[model samples]
Target: MVAQDFIVDLNKPLVFQVGHLGEAYQEWVHQPIVSKEGPRFFESDFWEFLTRTVWWAVPLIWLPVVCWCISMSIRMGHSLPQISLMVVSGIFIWTLLEYTLHRFLFHIETKSYWGNTIHYLLHGCHHKHPMDGLRLVFPPTATAVLCLPFWNLVQLMSTPSITPALFGGGLLGYVIYDVTHYYLHHGQPSSEVPRNLKKYHLNHHFRIQNQGFGITSSLWDKVFGTLPQSKAAKKSR
Candidate 1:
């Protein structure tokens, strides 16, 4: 398909067709097609509205949960040292989880109809419309639904006294990840850390979608051997 064939209507709701995965995926991963209008996944206005979320809403939705978790952990009589260690561990775990999910799950390839549709709905839409600010962050409703199994897993592994602290730290790490992701996409960074991160993330989106899965930190990418090729190396290739 030619560039002119992929026109998007700003006034109407963005509706992706069931096919066109090949051409659409190529354009999206390389030169992203940004849209001013939001996409509609459901016929119901309320359900469709639930899928869109603002960047600030991430912290607003999760911060209280994090605070409550920590408070509950303290009230449960867990020692400061234990709670501190567990919380830090949880944050560290989140980094790995982030990398794994991005690389393995979000980027999963499928050719079947329903599988491809699910994949597009989950992550492909973001790549296709990177500038759709409302859809950049994960919706709170989806996050809450996904957190059920994670919370259950935490409960199974740790005592109630320590679980809250651990879960709190993980939740905080997620907030950081989401906020940092939004900043990477939309904010201009003056500092070295964010500047480097912005470049790294943009490279992932435009140059090497398979590599550089780490968003909050590239340490995992470095360790997992998924770091994007250097500019010099790309030029040589």
Candidate 2:
């Protein structure tokens, strides 16, 4: 079935069919359907409802978490420069993590039935329906769940005085990543940098799927040699 014909109804439970298997799954991955209605993943209304989120919630949810971490770091007697360095380090760390996850986890290919479904729910849906405002940013609830393990990992490597600031910087980086990602999809950019970023990202979506994985900055893409070629180069070829 063509994607346009597929509709996810919140009022009803999902019933998977063989027709939605194999080739249909590949199409869903490569050429995602753009739908006016939100896609339903869970049968439980509460769980399904949590999947859809507003873009502004990224800052609203993470900014406070960042502030709390920094404030705690201050109370613990870290100097401004020390905290700044840790935070900067954290932001740097997040950029690598972002690129890694986008390139590796989000793009992993799976042929199994459940694998495709899970993949679609995680990232494929975004590719298929690029303009879905609800799915543009990671849901705060999901982000919070992920933050715990990441925070624990940071604590393992750093002192208490420095860990919060470091984690806070990482959080801030994530906020930037999400907001930048949303803007790349929905916002209009007049500046050259953002315009270039938007062009790079859209090309990743519409033209070259594997390249241009970095969203906030193309630094990782450049380092990893996955950066998309220039339009001039493509034209020449």
Extract clashing residue pairs from model 2.
32-128
Q: What's the residue-level lDDT of 50 in candidate 1?
A: 82
Could you tell me every candidate's TM-score relative to the true structure?
0.87, 0.88
The lowest-lDDT stretch of 10 consecutive residues in candidate 1 is 14-23
Best by TM-score: 2
| Residue pairs that clash (backbone atoms under 3 angstroms), model 1 | none
Question: Which run of 10 residues does model 2 get worst, by summed lDDT?
Answer: 10-19
Q: What is the lDDT of residue 127 in candidate 1?
A: 76
Give lDDT tens digits, candidate 2, residues 1-237: 554455544355432431245545655567755565655656778877887888899998889989999989999998899889988999999999999999999998766667767777778778877888888899888898899999998899799888999999999999999999999988999999999899989889898898999999899999989988987998999
lDDT of 2 at 124: 77
lDDT of 1 by residue, 1-237 (tens): 553255545344443443334445444434566565656666678867887899999999899999999989888888888878888888988899899889998888755546656777778777766777888889998899988887887888788787889888888889999999989988999999999999999888877888999999999999989998899987998
